[model samples]
Target: MHELIVSPYMGRFVMVKPGRKEGGTMPAYLYRELAETAPTSPCPDWLVKAARQAWHTELEGRPLAPAVLVRDDPGLGYGRASWELNLGCNYDCEHCYLGIKDFAGLELPERVRVLHTLRDAGVLWLQLTGGEPMVDRLFTETYAAAYDLGMMLTVLSNGSRLFLPKVLDLLTERRPDRVTLSVYGATEESYDGLTRRKGAYRLFKKGLDAGHEAGLPLSLSMIVTRHNAHEVPMMRHIAERIGAPMEEYTNMVPTIYGGDETLPTQSAEHLRRRKPFTGCNAGHTFFHVNPFGRASICKVGRDPAVDLLAEGVEGLSRLGAIADSLLLRQGGCTGCGLQGTCGTCMPLVQLYRKAEAPLATYCQHREKEESV
Candidate 1:
């Protein structure tokens, strides 16, 4: 194995080895530096802004509920909840809509206020996701505060920045119960091919190793795409190597970039190989906050005219009525072979101008997989 040099810290960037490529063992000095300071550059600036928002709410004394999961009975544990904490990221990997160029940062406090509102409304399971949440400096204090509030905090990340010894220490100190890392590729070429970089595969792997060494509860998250879908085995290999849980989902939304082409395309074989899914429980369960603060029904819904934050949750529920319009209910859902047993693909409706069609590949490929 070739010796990999530790790369200097870029903005929230943790594993860009400098002197050598990352095919072999990591440099000893790099490990020492990581042990010293948690990577702080990748942290987003909006975290502070979110705190300010919480302060404003405190001053106003107006209590707002967050994504509340109303339980008729009980038995529910840490009901599902997630927040798209920001729109910034450290890489421009294919299959990511944010790979588009015009992405900007979200105001920090506004997000914090939203969290406060949601937590107050009974949200317990919290997921902070973005280009990458670990890079945001605000995560330092936010994780601490959330844990103090008795909220189970989780960070959805790319595993690029977590390699720094310091970053790993901070995560351990905060002790976030869960960190979901998206493993793009197992090898450097496959990972670089998707991320459009030459060495992202190594950086991601190194960071993940650091996170695991820190004794954090880590899970591997994957988006099944044609470009990297074939690498599913690779992702699984990673999960096995690290003892992390592995999960993969069909394309949630289509390519929605305004200008640049060069988007990812999944192969029929890959789409077929993907776990069969039917519809999405998005609006009925989860939702998204756009860069401008509009709370849309799904990640691809960027309708600024219907801003959920501005209108509030009530407004959000009302606006998503657009989702149920006569036109959306199309596609033969009745008597479908995979109806009750499969997950929803509802996000595709808004992402594509056309009505949601049956994922032919999904239906055909998994027609014979024995029920688990």
Candidate 2:
């Protein structure tokens, strides 16, 4: 009988037909490995590739493109979580939302406590993001802790630290479900130039090479700002060389504290705003926990957070209520002439405007949409 395997890491379903060469039987462990790595047994190279392509196509058609699951759980009753392991990072990018400063996050014991809390809350998948999670003092132990909990892990990093022997060993032993490396530049000139750190590009390249060799599932992303926009093509070429797909993002909102808007991009029209603003999974089946243990609907989303350390799963229960409250406060965008055209949502309105009023700067979309 043929078996259909769901790869949570790769987000694809592969059709496996046991080959007749080995007594017409393939072991179950082989299926698991195949699901994770796309091994050359029980399937040809072409079929494996085709299956992956089909899966990505399916994902793009869905409302939440990155969430790959066999079934859709609306409540996300037991779902995915994003952890900002720490606010400390190794590199300082000019357009960074956090403004490129280092600070201590939770202590190691507290971090472990947070992991236990998430696993208990039925959070099976975790995305460990950061100011650069690698720089966190407790990163390795916390990663091991998550792996021990049988939770699928995805790490977002600048890739500079993966070259260390200890880091590589941890990744090789307890392989994360996926690793996404943020590519700063195709060359050292633009990379170190943008980050203002000498030899940053070299370290990033070394990390990528090490990660590729360790067989880690990798992807590349470039935050397209004015300075590095010209190097985007070169970055894509680097992604191809690393055998990882490239994702480019241009819609950079101001920092959570409304710090700066100096980064240039395509246009306000390209922002990720949909009518009625209902596509987000934040505070429902998904939530973001920042360095200080503040849990919100999303990473960029601030205000109305429940302290995960103090509240635990019980606090998480209030997120739905918090979300309901945010949704209720839709403000002027509720029935504006540019409702469908503007990207303003409650969290964004909170970010840029005064407590009682919407910001006219954010309303620039109305004029643009009307003039068109």
Candidate 3:
């Protein structure tokens, strides 16, 4: 495995280290020149200069072998992707968007195939997520495969299994770009109550401390639900104590399957107003995949997904059009006068409508246009 990756990301050239802790942009011409350099040739002076400036590494006279320099293919224009390894989780939180958590996923053979497919699809940045990714039986294998294939990996977990020797060792050996753990609460009582799992908080704290001690790049998602809304201050304190950046999430939406069971968990006081819906490069520059290899424009707009395993990379040809159609303001949003100021995107609005959720939760129409 190379210590550095020189690759094309959505039309831009980037020089990134393995774990992605440090990186910066490089000239396109230089990237091409390096790509054409002989493997056994001396490491180019430009690389040394860039590495020194960007990563502060001293590669004075190293050989230009695959271990020192890995070049990534700019495949199919897709640069990033997220995959749900499985829907299984140890802690079932009240605010979880996955309605039904099942302990099932593709076997090892199929999982490896999916990872290769992701690599071939030009995914340099890949997020391995799940109901709780660590709970999947083949989680470590899948992670290792992706990392070895030169993708900068990110793991989204609940911090419940990071303390285990196997999990910690694997992470320490092959560090991910980031380990994003969702913090449910600052106290055991509040955390356990919110997750509906007794003693869940203890395990989470242990795992968090271990991960930090192992020098892993970690971040915290401060999940604010009605059950733990009072602990926001303490959550911030915990994040600061661990020296990891924290982001608060207050807008609780319906489950991915359009179930309204999670709506009650929203923290009314902490619900922040979303920014105006500009636009996203979801299907054009990136995509998402489920545990079963179904690829979609993004996690929110999962319909019209392509069976990646069956159709292969060519199937992704349909996602850009799918995204375009989904983004069109239709159904409940059609001809809405508030389209200019609405913050929610059409796909998410479709989900809210499917759940028959209160308009106040997702729309400005009820509050502004109708009332006026």
Most TM-score-accurate candidate: 3
Of candidates 3 and 1, the better by lDDT: 3
TM-score-wise, the better of 1 and 2 is 2
What TM-score does prediction 1 earn? 0.62
Candidate 2, residue 221: the lDDT equals: 87
TM-score of each: 0.62, 0.74, 0.96
Query: How does candidate 3 score on lDDT?
Result: 0.87
In the range 222-295, model 2's lDDT, one tens digit per residue, is: 87666677787788899888778888876666666765543343334434433445446678877889888888
Clashes of 1: 32
Best candidate, lDDT-wise? 3
Clash count list over all predictions: 32, 0, 0
For every candidate in turn, the CA RMSD to the true structure comes to 15.8, 9.7, 1.5
Q: What is the lDDT of candidate 1?
A: 0.53
Q: Is candidate 1 or 3 superior in TM-score? A: 3
Q: Mind giving the per-residue lDDT tens digits that candidate 3 earns over 97-198?
A: 889998887888888888788777788899999989998989999998888887899999998999999999998888899999999999999999999999
Better candidate number, 2 or 3, judged by lDDT: 3
